[model samples]
Target: MRVIFAGGGTGGHLYPALAVAEELSSRDPGFEALFVGTSRGIESRVVPASGYGLELISSRGARGKGAAGKAVTGAMLAAGTFQAMGIIRRFKPDLVFGSGGYASVAAVCAGWLMRKTVVLQEQNSVPGLANRTLAPMARRLYLGFEKARGYFRRGAPVVVTGNPLRGAIKPGPDRDARKDFGLSGDGPVLLVFGGSQGAMTLSRAAAGYLLRRTDVQAII
Candidate 1:
């Protein structure tokens, strides 16, 4: 079966889609999956490395912008819709997974318009605009946080499946991980990951706290 995975611009959106794609491939050796994302998104680098065919689409966010910015975003979204429609027609995918980002808006809409099965996965405490807008049309909705249910329309087929993370993101003994990282496991351990690109604000806050408390053993 052919499937299309759409979403990017951030690890929050991209990683979940990757995880799902991985699962799909594992389930069926013949299953084919294609990734749709914007050229500027991290997907340009990450998707190809993951061994998935990546298709580029033009998309921009419409939220938190002035009139001009909104207009530009709208135009981009329109163009992206046409591009996504073309991809959908050519691919003839059995299913389309929307991973929640501005990059996913057009693809998901196109899939729905084409009457293909569309599933949406939301990874945030609060659903983003793209997911919220597509929720009503999605055949199924997977949410990372239960709190997000209230944001969607009632009677939507929402399921709290939590975030779909990569296979490498498994839980293990902290001490072993610390030792592997060349850190002593004898003291308190603080593991801080600031996403793929590194969250500067979170890094600074963690640094400030560590500076104030030298007794804490941190793996940032």
Candidate 2:
């Protein structure tokens, strides 16, 4: 089966789709997958490395933008939809899966307009604007949090699937893991990460907190 996975700007919006695609490929050796995202997103780097094809579209976040910026974003989204439609036509995917992000908006809409089966996966308790807008077009909605169900339209085919995790992730011995990182005598090791596209605010906060604690070892 061929599938088009759309979404990416950060790891939060991208990784789940990758995890699902990876699982599908493993389960079915003949499974084919293509990723749709913006060139600026982390997917540009990660997708190819994961051995999947990626198609880039013109898109950007409309939220927190000024009127002029929002207008420009809208124009980009319209263009992106057209670009996605072209990709969908050429790829002829059996299914189009959308993970919430600005990049998914165009691909999902294009797929729905083309009368293709569309599915969505939302990884946050509060749904994003793209997912909320496209929820009506989806045949199924998979959510990371059960509380997110209330945000979509009533009677929507919502399923609480939690978040898709990569197969490579598994529990390992804490001491061994710490040793691998060259950390010894751990007085509670703190690991701080801001997803694929790092968040400056989160990094700053972590930095401030770590500065006050000498007993804590961190992997940033």
Could you say which candidate leads in TM-score?
A: 1
| Tens digit per residue, CA lDDT, model 1, 152-220 | 988889999988878988899877788798987577778788664347888889999999887788878
TM-scores for every candidate against the unseen true structure: 0.88, 0.85
Q: Kindly list the per-residue Cα lDDT of model 2 for residues 117-193, writing each as its tens digit.
A: 99999998888889999999999999999999999878999999999999999999998998899999558998887
The deviation in Å at residue 156 for candidate 2 is 1.6
| Clashing pairs in model 1, backbone N/Cα/C closer than 3 A | none
Off by over 4 Å in 1: 195-215
Best by lDDT: 2
Error of 2 at 4 (Å): 0.4
